[model samples]
Target chain A: MSELTYRDALNLALKEEMRRDPSVVVFGEDVALYEGSFKVTRGLLAEFGEERVKDTPISENTIVGVAVGAAMGGLRPVAELMTVNFALLAMDQIVNHMAKVRSMFGGQTHLPMVVRMPGGGGSQLGAQHSQSLESYFMHCPGLRIAYPATPADAKGLLKTAIRDPNPVIFLEHELLYNSKGEVPDDPEFLVPFGKANVVREGSDVTVVAYARMTVLALQAATELAKEGISCEVIDLRTLNPLDVETFVASVRKTGRAVVVEECWRTAGLGGDLAHRIHEACFDTLRAPVRRVAGLDVPMPYSREIEKLCIPRVETIAAAVRDVLAASV
Target chain B: METKLRAVLPDHELVKLYEQMVIGREFEEACAEQYTKGHITGFLHLYSGQEAVAVGATAGLHKDDYILSAYREHAQAIVRGAEPKRVMAELFGKATGLCKGKGGSMHLFAPELSFMGGYAIVGGQLPVACGLAFSAKYRQEDRITACFFGDGAVNQGTFHESLNWARLWELPVLFVCENNFYGIGTEVHRSSALPTVHKRTCGYDIPSEKVDGMDVVAVFKAVKYAAEKVRESGRPYFIEATTYRFRGHSMADPAKYRSAAEHEIWKSRDPIPAFARRLLDEGIAAEEELEAIRKRCTATVQDAVTFAEESPWPEDRQIWEDIYV
Candidate 1:
């Protein structure tokens, strides 16, 4: 195993995939020369030819549409949309064409394409660029949604997404790109979708999250452990074909659950998970499942106000403490 | 550069165009007939009067070239190698249909024939066609992508974005705008500030021309030239086939926006019968031959109806079949 940041893991995955498959190509704003806004595509242009690692115009729809056509024409395309907020421009291609093509065509073709978008709202980028669109994509069928927290899971899940025949909406948390972890050095360490990882096993409560939110939950779990509170943190690696059984098992065992989300509270993915938890583990639950989520308002430009929107370690810890208090 | 109509396409080719137009008209009428009988369901946008746009343009393409169009594409698919029986079955929502009844009439597909799909979103096919052209060019294939859409689609952002991208990359895309003057209830005049659809491409320096959509020979000549330019230069070319839709936008539309007098003025120039008269007047074919062509088109459509009626519904288990690979 080697220590790598989440960004490097993503870059390594692209490099390895491009080297393995001649048809695999990467493109987007600054993805070629500047190596992406978050530097996730650093050194890709050097390794792959300019034709393969292309820089596209600011047209997000065209970028995705091109990837869709290229994928249908027997190429594996990883089209980065810069940020999830910008995905609104290409929503037609994503929802109408990419997600529906294979099924609509009656299985005549497969869209083996991946759309990477930096998501979630911690960095104070404000309303236009900071919205988390994972829930929007999760509601749609004919798509696989992946959000990895650690470097290891990032690399493994990305490779699996590249290999999978469906169109994958890969949500990369902008905050987690700088976070470092010990990624397995094995070239073939592929992670399967619909599987949740219990990062820190515990007995009292289950905190469900993915991507950067998982890191926050982990930090809260660390503090909660110090307070003699055992928290089982479940990292939902993929949200669409969700590993409900894992959450069900955890909720049944712990008898208390808290869903931590970086997105807004109103009609959020956390709400969906909380509803599922209630349906599956109602008798087992000692307290109502609580949600520590982002404020249901547009993210402000001020750093302090932006911090107020997303869930911090203390915020998650407080939510877990409330569940603990309720049980007592 | 204006070649004689007979010189460009011989007498036999004219007859074929007539037959294709007739098939398109007859097929659309049949769809309306079946829809009324509760056989075919969903949004049925009849290409009753816009038949020449498909026939004239598809005639200019090789079998290997790609064809992408908006929702009004039953005629385009028929002109481009899709079997009539399958197309009919598609409209009928039968399992034997082109898309196995999943897409109904709006999303027909024949990748083997290089006919991509009939997208429902107005300008959704623009970028897709450009991407298909990019693939063809990047793979060093000499194929061109003919993208067809209505006048209403020109107002969409994808149209301008795709035009710029196609020109910037020098991709082979023949942007065929069948400007039938209506986007649902809104007329082209109501939508576009500058009404000429072909002139819109001038901003991107994509060469374009306006063709008489009612005249099959004119549409054929213009599309042929545009397709050739796109193939030769590997750059996007635009052609506005100024046609008219004889029927309402879809089966349910009342067409309350336009007047009967205006419709009559255009109907006098209906492409199918007008071309048939020209075929005989130009000494291309006898009146008996025209009757024979109509009989043949009727037979083809009749066989298609039988195939659709007999075709089975898709199995229930197939619902989750092709969403993923």
Candidate 2:
């Protein structure tokens, strides 16, 4: 194991995958000479050359459509949208082409491809730039969604996503890039999908979250621990192949749950997760499942107001406390 | 005196082209019959009057060249050697279909034949075609991609984006615009800024041409030249085949928007009989031989219908299959 930042771990994953498979190619706006808008593709052009690493025109829809075509033409392509919010421009290609190609074509071909986007509302980038569209992708079938919280998972899950035969929407949080952790150095190391990681083990309450929210949940677990509130923090590695079994089992043991999400509250993924927990562990529950979700509004530009919109460590801890205090 | 077409291809090859066009016409007409009987469901876009574009273009390119098309692609698939019976079964939603009944008329795909797929959304296939060409170039392969769409797709952002991307990368992509003059009910003049579809490629810096789509030989010659230019230059080329569809966009349309005189004018230029006349005049084929070819085509389409009727429905378990690999 080696200590690395979340950004470096992802860059390493891309390098390792490209080195391992010649069929793997990378492209997007500023992905080649510029390294990347976020520098996640740093040193790729130098090592892989222009053929495998290319800087495309600012055509989000075409970027994904070209990736789908390349995947069909027997190349594993990884495309990057500048930000998750820009993925809306490519929704026609993402939902209709990339997701539907394998099944709509009657299993004739598999799209071994990944579309990476860095997103989350924390830095007061305002309404358009800072938005969590995870639930938008989750609503669509025939897609694999991976959002890793820790540097270790950022490397492992991305490697697995690159190697998977299906199309993967690999989401990276904008705020977690600088956070450091011990990542496995094994080039062959791969974290499988549909498995949630228990970042913190406790018996009093189950905290379910992913991406940046997972970090906040872990921090909340640490804060709650001082008050004798043992909270189990579950980092959901992949959403589509959601390991509801892991969280359901945890909720069953704890008898209380708080589902945390950075997206809007209305029809959010938290609603779906909370419903699943209630349906599975209703008989074993001490209280109804609680949710800590982003407020329903376009993100505000002020740092103080922006912090209030998304989930924070204090808010997560409060939700866990609220869930524990309630009785069935 | 030998005709220009006689100099380009042998007698048998010329007859084969006529045969393929006949098969396309017969198959589409059969689909109309089946659709009326409720054997085929969903959007049915027939390639009736535009048979020449598919047949001529398919004949123009190499067998290994990847072909992608819009929803009006039954004729393209058949010309590219997809078994007519299986394609018919696909439309019939039978287990024996090309896509095992998963992809209906709008999404026929046969990878083995290098027939990529038929996209329902207008202009969706353009970028995909560029991608295929990009892949071919990246891997140092010789294959090129031939993408076919209608005039309706020209207004789409993907059409411009794909064209620009293909040229910027200098990928081997032949953009064939089957300008049937209508995007559903809207005429080409009404829908486009510059209704001359071929002229639009100038914005992308890709060389292009317009051909008489009613003349199968003209379409074949233009596509043949354009496809070779793309392959040799490792760049994109565009061709706007000026044709007209005999039917509405799909079965749902009544085609009341088209004038009766315009319809008659295009109908008189029907490629199948026009080509047959050329063949006879050139002494390339006898009248009895042309009749025999038509008979053979009709029989083939009939067999496809029989195969589709007999084919079983896909198993219930299959619904959960193929979403992931």
Candidate 3:
């Protein structure tokens, strides 16, 4: 095992995959000469040369569309969009083409490609930039969505995403880029999709989350442990083929659940998770399923207001306490 | 001015080109007939007036070369060797269709034949075509991607982005614009500042030209030359083929935008008969032989209609499948 930041883990995954497979290529705006705006693609251009690692014009739609074509033409292309907020510009390609091509073309082709974007609302990047649009991707039918919360998962899940025979929307948290954790040194280590991790084991209240919210949920669990409340935290690494069994099983065991998502509350992933939990463990539930989600307003520019918009550790813990308190 | 034509290609191949154009025109006429009879449904865009561009362009490219186009691409795929029966079956939403009825008229795909697809969204296929060419270049394969779009697609941002990327990477791609004058109801002059489609590629430093789309020989010569240049230089080239669509944009529109005088002028230069006249004048094929070719094309399209009528509907379970790998 080696200590690595989430950013470095992603970089290592790209380098290892490029070295292992000659068909693997990376491209995006500023990804080659700029070594990535977040430096996750650092040293890739130097290692793979310009043919494989490319710097493209600022065309988000075409960037993703080209990756779709490249994937159809038998090359594994990993495209970056600088950030997930920019992906809205490419929604036509992302939703209409990338996600629909396989099925639309009658399975004559499969897109073995990954579109990586860093998102989440901690850096105060403002209303347009600070959005977390993971739900938008998860809602799409023909895509696999993966958002890793740790360095190990960042490397493992990214490798899996790169190798999968379908298009993957690999979302990274901008705030988690600098967070360091232990990553397995094995080049072949791959985190499978649809497998939720039990980050913390408890029996009182199950906290289901992923990406940055997973970190906050774990923190809430730790603080709740001091107050004699055991909160089980479930990190859903992959959202599409979501491991509802793990969270449902956790909720069944705990008899209460609180789902947290960094995105807005209305029609967010939290609602989806809560519905699944309610459906699976309705008979065993001692309290109603609660959700700790971001406010339903557009993310603000001010740091103070932005902090309020997203779910915090305190917000998550308080939700857990609410569910636990209502149980008795 | 009547440009005197020389026998640039062999007699047999020239006759074959004439035969393919006849087949395309026959197939499109059948599609229109089928649409009227309610056999083929939903957004049927006929390629009647634009047959030569598809036939000539397809004939000029290698079989291995990739061809991608916009929705009016039944001719493009048929010319590149997609069977008319299966294409008709797709329009009928049958299980034996090109996309197994999942992709109807607007999205026909046969990847094995290197017909990437026919995208419905305007200019959506440009960047994807660039990627296909990029892959060929990266693998050091000597194949060029021929991307066909209508004049309407030039207004899209993807047109500019794809042109710049294709030229920037120096990928081998031939961007063919079928300038049918009107984008549905709106004419090109009202929408575009320059009004000339080929000149738009100048910003990317990609060499381009304009060809008379109604003339099969002109389109063939231009695309053949452009494809060769792209193959040799490993760069993208643009060609704007000035053509007109005889039918409306889709099956819905009546195409009231063009005047009766203008319509008469384009119809007088209809590619299939014009090319046939040239062929007969050049003593390439006898009148009896040309009649035999027309009969054969009609028979081919008739068989396709019969096949589509007999094909079964897709099973209910199939709807759930193909959404993933």
**Which has the greatest TM-score?**
2
The clash count of every prediction, one per candidate, is: 0, 0, 0
Candidate 2 clash total?
Answer: 0
Best candidate, DockQ: 2
Q: Which stretches of candidate 2 lie over 4 Å from their true place?
A: B1-3
lDDT of 2 by residue, A1-328 (tens): 9999999999999999999999999999999999999999999999999999999999999999999999999999999999999999999999999999999899999899999999998988999999999999999999999999999999999999999999999999999999999999999989999999999999999999999999999888988999999999999999989999999999999999999999999999999999999899999999998899999999999988989999999999998888877865
**When only chain A is evaluated, what TM-score does every model earn?**
0.98, 0.99, 0.99
Candidate 2 lDDT over B64-161, as tens digits, reads 99999999999999999998999999999999999999999999999999999999889999999999999999989888999999999999999999
Please state the CAPRI-style docking class of candidate 1. Answer: medium
DockQ of 1: 0.70
**Residue B236's C-alpha lDDT in candidate 2?**
94
Put down candidate 3 lDDT per residue, B1-325, tens digits, no spaces. Answer: 5554554788888888888889888988899899999998889998889988998898789999999999998988888889999999999999999999999888999988999999999999999999999999999887999999999999999999999999998999999999999999999999999999898888999999999999998999999999999999999999999999998998899998889899999999999899989888878889999999999999999999999999999999999999887
Provide the overall lDDT of each model, using Cα atoms, as 2-decimal numbers.
Answer: 0.89, 0.94, 0.93
Two-chain DockQ for each candidate model: 0.70, 0.88, 0.84
